[model samples]
Target: MSRDEIIDITNKFLVEEFEVDTEVVQAEANLKDSLDLDSLDYVDLVVIIESNFGIKLESKDFTDVNTFNDLYDLIGSKLHAIA
Candidate 1:
């Protein structure tokens, strides 16, 4: 999927699950810090991504994904590899 598509899906999930404003879920936003996402939320997010994108994201895969842009890159790469 394209970066814009990934961001749109991610932002939609965040809006529905976390009640976050889609406008605030920008590429530069920090997923953990800026969003204040807890561990369980992270797990749920991973599950959502896996189910929707068909990519198995291990905990280690998230080690370096601190920001939304980081996550976008990770998911984008996973989508590319799978395709």
Candidate 2:
């Protein structure tokens, strides 16, 4: 999928599944701070990524992911690797 599609899907999931405010979910928005996510929320995020993108993510995969853009790039890299 294209980056725009990835952004749309990720944004949709964050808004619907995580109850994140759509207004706060910008590309550069801080993932945890913007979404008010905790450690348990990370677990849910992992499951969401895997189920939605078919990308299995470990905690380490999130170590460098600070912003929604970071997460989007990470997902793109993982998807590229799979392809």
Candidate 3:
């Protein structure tokens, strides 16, 4: 998938699964802060990502993920690895 597609789908699920406003799901937005995700929310996020993107994301996978763009890159890399 292209970067645009990744961003599109990520935004969709973030809105649907997390109840985040679409406006808040910007590329530069801080993932945890923008989504208001805590520890349990992180677990739920892992599940949501796997279900939506078909990639299993471990907790450590998010160590360097700060913004939504970072997440898009992470997911894109994992998808590339699997492909």
Candidate 4:
């Protein structure tokens, strides 16, 4: 999938599943703050990402993900690796 497709899918799921406002789901937004995600939320995030992109992600994969763009980049890299 293209980068745009990844962004679209990520935003759609964030808004739908996590109940995040569409306006707060921008690339520069802080993932934890925007999603109001706690530790347990990280597990949910991992599941959501795998189900959405068909790529396996460990909690460690999110260690560097401070912003939404970081998460997008991580997913992009994983998808590229799988391809």
Q: What local distance difference test score does each model get?
A: 0.86, 0.92, 0.91, 0.93
Off by over 4 Å in 1: none
Clash number for each model: 0, 0, 0, 0
lDDT of 1 by residue, 1-83 (tens): 77899988877877788887777787887889767888998898899889878898999999999889999899999999889
Estimate, for each residue in 3-71, the C-alpha lDDT of model 2 and write its tens digit: 999999999999998886799999888999999999999999889989999987888999999999999
RMSD of 4: 0.7
Candidates' RMSD to native:
1.1, 0.7, 0.8, 0.7
Sorted on lDDT, best first, the list reads 4, 2, 3, 1
Worst 10 residues of 1 by lDDT: 20-29
Regions more than 4 Å wrong, model 4: none
lDDT of 4: 0.93
What TM-score does prediction 4 earn? 0.96
* Candidate 3 displacement at residue 65 in angstroms: 0.4
TM-score of 3: 0.95
- The whole-model C-alpha lDDT of candidate 2 against the native structure comes to 0.92
Tell me the lDDT of candidate 3: 0.91
Off by over 4 Å in 2: none
Alpha-carbon runs more than 4 Å astray in model 3? none
Q: Give, for candidate 2, the lowest lDDT window spanning 10 residues.
A: 17-26
